[model samples]
Target: MDFQRTLLIGGLAIVGYLMILQWDKDYNQVPTTTQQQEQHQTVPSTEDAPQLTQAKQGASDDVPMLDSVADAPTDDTAADKQVVTVTTDTFAVEIDTKGGNIVKASLLKYPVKLPDDNEPNPAPFTLLERSSARTFIAQSGLIGPDGTDSKGKATYQAAQTNYQLNGGETLNVDLSLVDKKGVKVIKRYTFTKGSYEVKVSYVVDNTSSTTWQANLYAQLKRDNTQDPSNSSSSMGMSTYLGAAVRGKEERYVKLPFDEFEEEKFNADVTGGYAAVLQHYFVSAWIPNQEQLNNFYTRKAGSNNIVGFKNQNNPLKLAAGEKGEISATLYLGPKDQKRLAELADGLELTIDYGVLWFVAQPLFWLLTFIHSLIPNWGWSIILLTVMVKAAFYPLSAASYRSMANMRRLSPKLQEMRERYGDDRQKMSQAMMEMYKKEKINPLGGCLPILVQMPVFIALYWVLLESVELRQAPWLGWITDLSVKDPYFILPLIMGASMFVQQLLNPTPPDPMQAKVMKLMPIIFTVFFLFFPAGLVLYWVVNNLLSIAQQWMITRQIEGQAAAKSTK
Candidate 1:
């Protein structure tokens, strides 16, 4: 009966955990707003410009003529399009001069795969590409009268086809274009030695007699195609692939591809950022903090666009005057520390489920431990030890309660046999026995309830931490983020769980006893698909728990025996 009650509590905790995961998935499916409906109706074809009357009217009173220019022709000639390559320590980017768009970006340090026979030397991980089947690129342009942008019908000329950092502190790639009206626009891309962020700025030099007026727009364009490399062991474990926007009222707003197709997101925010997020990497455009910007997310045919544009407060540059508009672009692995430094709430991209408050500190601790011990696997082991030590007193009490119950198991069985079919009498007799023994029937369940959040939070920390990707532990444990190659750790965990179960008191009910006996097998099957790091943590934790419970039970039984003899 006691075991049945404990199982009920465990079942409730598992149900709650599953509910949180489901809620998070559903939360990303945001409701369609009225503005989104209007924008959806106004979204024009690929060959035309999006109608801006509704958006312009909704703009702040300060800006009157805020509108987006017509999109560039989809069938632009690629034969003559010049490609500029910028090589930095962290990444290599290829930009097309047609609109100064970053069409191809490869993480120079990260390989596409750990090792493969087909490709002896695997290529670098490609973050952005422009192929016939897939189109993912970072695009920016100017919108308004006399503005020359890549997204528009303006072509730029690059100064050089290749630019290398070559151990230098900074490297710059310049793409220049002169409008028919003689407005010279130089698009400069600045890359640092060891940073993924590229500083993109446009130097608009008005060479004509009239003033140059336009708004700078930057966006990420990608299709709904999923990356084959992001597969998980199960369907429920798929990573989120979509857009996220940070604004004044909204901290972290997710705009999924399906949701974007149903409704667009349009808002004006100061110090905002728009990003396209995937499993381990993210590409975001963070505009100047002091400027008010218009952030939007919409779908164009098979592609999804997420971007922000500086408010249409025209950069009125007179003849011979030059104006520079700049923003930072981040394209690399989602390192929480670096991402947080880049923009507010950017670290949220490394999702830790719904219990972020608990997961964040746990991740910080894990990182700190990793700093001290280079091996992430060892860090997880030490983290489990620390967590167990923190809850030692509660666990000891729970163990002692179970020990008391185990000591009285014979009496409990006799009472059950005597009361046969009378459940009321059996329960009453069990309550009296518990009261006389000064044992709390629910004490053993409390420790488990308390540990559930910590364990679940650590699960996310292991799942989301890129530092564990391809990280090796001992022999055969090549990637801590992946399942054990031999399934040894899971088997060991199951053995330890079985040992711990044997130490607990047997349930009076035969049905409950059978269910309890199968728990270790059930958990072992589940852990077979979990990451090695998480499985390692559970194995270590279970071993330590068995040892602690054994010692506590022995002490309690010794005292009870002495009292009975006296």
Candidate 2:
């Protein structure tokens, strides 16, 4: 086959693969409606109820609690609960006194997109909110046989309604809840300067004569609601919006909202975390790694909850003794480096599809380039150049093969005419001609096949990188994550593809040649709605390939002309 035909087949295969991916994302997805989730909700049985294991004699060990507590008071009690507001450099959070739950959180550094007619300043992006149409909050408390928290029923009183980190290094806010049995539980939230991770600690004070035993549970609760900022055009390439977990056995597992409605997910692992993942942000509860823990996913009313709890062992605090259980709660963007430092496999929440092995290193290279250039757009261009340079030798060989095929086109056509009635004779003549020229018929395709994965991986890297969101290149091109509003980059890419095709041998098959002629138009139209950064990468790659192929073809043609003259 000719190089142009091979290229056409490869392009069609890629397009088909992408179409299948989009189809699976749209049609094959199991919808998880609010009604369906409600239907799946069932009352917890006694055996399934979380219990604190009995404390050993003279053993003062801490017991782990499940991630979520059931039967928490509904919205009716929210009116009675005091709202404590905590402000830091990066976050503005509201904690409810009812259960010391983080009822609302707003990212102070990130602003929501404003309407065209709106004022210049936009409000901060709210990650957790409690409204009629949406409800998302972080809840944590103690639950066990002798626990005061009956599914987070017990209410707490915050020391203050407003707390601020006024140029200070760290801020601490405490909410105290005392039950009728004289068990005191203090929920303390610790915030550090310029950090998204909050240190949540539950200090249990056993004042009663008998031993006090309970388990600590922390969970994230959020209703199924689509993000308002996600545009309709990008819906086909929707980002993952559900739960993710990382454990010792399972490196990274996703429990989408639909799967949660189908059945409950239960697992036991040491040093694992459960998080609610969205496009660029993640909220997770990181439990103590040394302790055995249980990861769970379930539906509660209109909310989907994913969390982890301590194992069955109950924490025992003797009379007049105090014990503390704590976990880190991270609520922020999906910064891969930061997430990786937080826990193993947490960075996988970025979701680079199945080609993560290639995509990850590509991302690292892009990041390194960005560190020096200070712009994601230029970093992408330079990265594309680096990738092309790395594969230049292979591509040069492929181009040489195509040049040989183009040189032999006349002889091959003559053979076809000589053996017009015999298919076997024509095949034998073509093989002899190829052998005489020392040409490999399949040489061009193998290099392309090998490089295809890297190209696809780079495509995903550009599509999913949050760093490029709302970033700008030169004139007209802004927001590399979105499509080019003017559609100029895609057109340039198509033009480059057409020129590259012209420099290679044309297919003999009429239908194949026609398809090859139309590939540029087809791909141009397809890429019109693709991300501008991705289009930029393609345009640059095509231009580079054209330059290389043209040079190689010219060099081979010059050498052949000199030999003929001799």
Candidate 3:
């Protein structure tokens, strides 16, 4: 074909290839499969409801022991309510719209984050009540006149609103306590949604004259419902108190929720299990060491207790008195950059997974490169260009080989027609001819092989990079993290590939020629499920390569004409 026709065919092939990729993805139905282990697992117990222990009489007044009331019905099953559960490979969430609380959130993944849609059986945080998606409710019992006794149970109302988030939306959770005593306590929790850490501001107002005192605790609890028969049950649910601990050798210090208020104590056991949440780092509005003992966890399971410090001043609430305190909760994810943005010391929350040493540095470098440009899509484009440029010498060598092969096509065709049925002789002659021309037959394949690693690295960069979450590109490409709604980029990519194919003359070997002809179709099918941004990068690179090759081809033709004249 003439050069102009070659370019048109190549361009059209590429466009067609990309279009096929996009269309194939649309019809590609990812089969849903559940593990047999998951189906056989036993249901978790929502019973054993968490309760604060009170010292029985006859126990020393100074030493108050914590204990649970045995007969306090813990059955979570309610009449006439449909409970919806969402689970992943590691986590299971039981959302009860009837109770208005996430009754149980079992941590199947030791360190998990909000699930992404790409995950199989993704468990997302959803609004129980559609009428008010932001509204969340909890039941904390009423305070006695003295503020220490339970007059009755009072339900607490917490609502998370104004969630119109565009990358940097702040979470405002309003927590209120409504009681029959005409007493009310309204607290607000506010923090940027971009980071998982949270801050709480408590405002308690009581119209009663009786003094009221209440203790505050940050609760992080999960149910263990995994069937004992399943291997995952042992590794199922885990909680890190303030921060995630690194390495497998060190385990969490287990303490009971109640044991924290007392003086010095320690417990240790070899066999059974008990877990204590540890803070990789913590900042709290609590008191000093001199007033009370700092609580530590004993490896023992049976004697677990919470760590605590004595109150420096009474949370005194007289008639018509209002008390307010503001504290922050670092609910950070296991992502370093996000954790780091939670005011320096907060990055301790990112578990780093297993490969923190290597992954951390890679993440840092990716973040640094991304910071240079605000558009995440462009950042990816620039990153791809840099990588390709770094390996340009290899690519150039491959292109040069193809150029030489194209120049010798006329001579190779003559040999092919002359020795049509002499397969062995034709192969021998082809090799001898290549040696005479000083061209490497293996040249094109080596560079393509070397490009694989860079491609894999970039793939990980796009998949793991949280910075790209909800990030937008120019038009119709609102979320680079998700698939493109319009398949424009992929179509362009396929067209470019077809163009690149046309520029390089076909091989004389029948088998090799057949494979080359099918390269565009083979690649189009492969690119179907690839992220739109990734396909776009390939399209741009292919187009750039086609232009470069065309220029080289023209240069060779011009030189040959000049030599003929001389």
Candidate 2: the clashing residue pairs are 53-314, 63-315, 65-310, 66-309, 67-309
Better of 2 and 3 by lDDT: 2
**Model 1 whole-model lDDT (C-alpha atoms):** 0.79
After the best TM-score superposition of candidate 3, give how far the Cα of residue 523 lies from its true spot, in angstroms.
3.6
- Candidate 3: tens digits of C-alpha lDDT, residues 61-167: 11111121111222233343434353433224343333223333333432222234666353332211111111111111112233221322223444432223344
Instruction: Compare the candidates by lDDT and give the number of the best one.
Output: 1
Candidate 3: deviation at residue 235, Å? 31
Global CA lDDT computed for model 2: 0.77
The lDDT for every candidate, in the order shown, is 0.79, 0.77, 0.46
**Residue pairs in candidate 1 whose N, alpha carbon or C atoms collide under 3 angstroms:** 99-150
Q: Superposing all C-alpha atoms, what RMSD in Å does each candidate have to the true structure?
A: 9.5, 8.8, 13.7
- Write the residue-wise lDDT of candidate 1 on 1-566 in tens digits: 99999999989957865664466456522223333335534653231223354234332111112354223323243346677998888888989787788988989887665664655576677788776435688887776666664223357887678889996899888888888888888889999989999999988888899877887888898888785335433322666788999966967888888887678888888877999888778899999877788888776656788898786455679788989988999998989989988888888988887888999999999999999999999999999999899989888988988888899999998997899999999999999999988889888889878878988888788888878877888888978876675667978999899999999999888999999999998898787667788889989999999999999999988998899899
- By summed lDDT, the worst window of 10 consecutive residues in model 2 runs over 54-63
Q: Alpha-carbon error at 545 in model 1, in Å? A: 1.1
The sequence of per-residue lDDT tens digits that candidate 2 reaches over residues 1-566 is: 69999999989967865775576467643223333324324432121112232111211111123443334322222346678999999999988776677877888876554222433665676787665546777877677776655433457888779999998999999998777778888889999999999999988888888888877677887778885334422633677788889755777998888777687778878777889887668888988877777888877545688887775655789888999888999998788999888877888988898999999999999999999999788998999999999999899999999998888878877876888869888888888878888899888789988999999999878877778766788788857766776667877998899998898887756689899999998898788777788889999999999999999999999999999999
Report backbone clashes per prediction. Answer: 1, 5, 21
Q: Which stretches of candidate 1 lie over 4 Å from their true place?
A: 1-79, 115-120, 149-153, 227-229, 232-236
Order of models, best TM-score first: 1, 2, 3
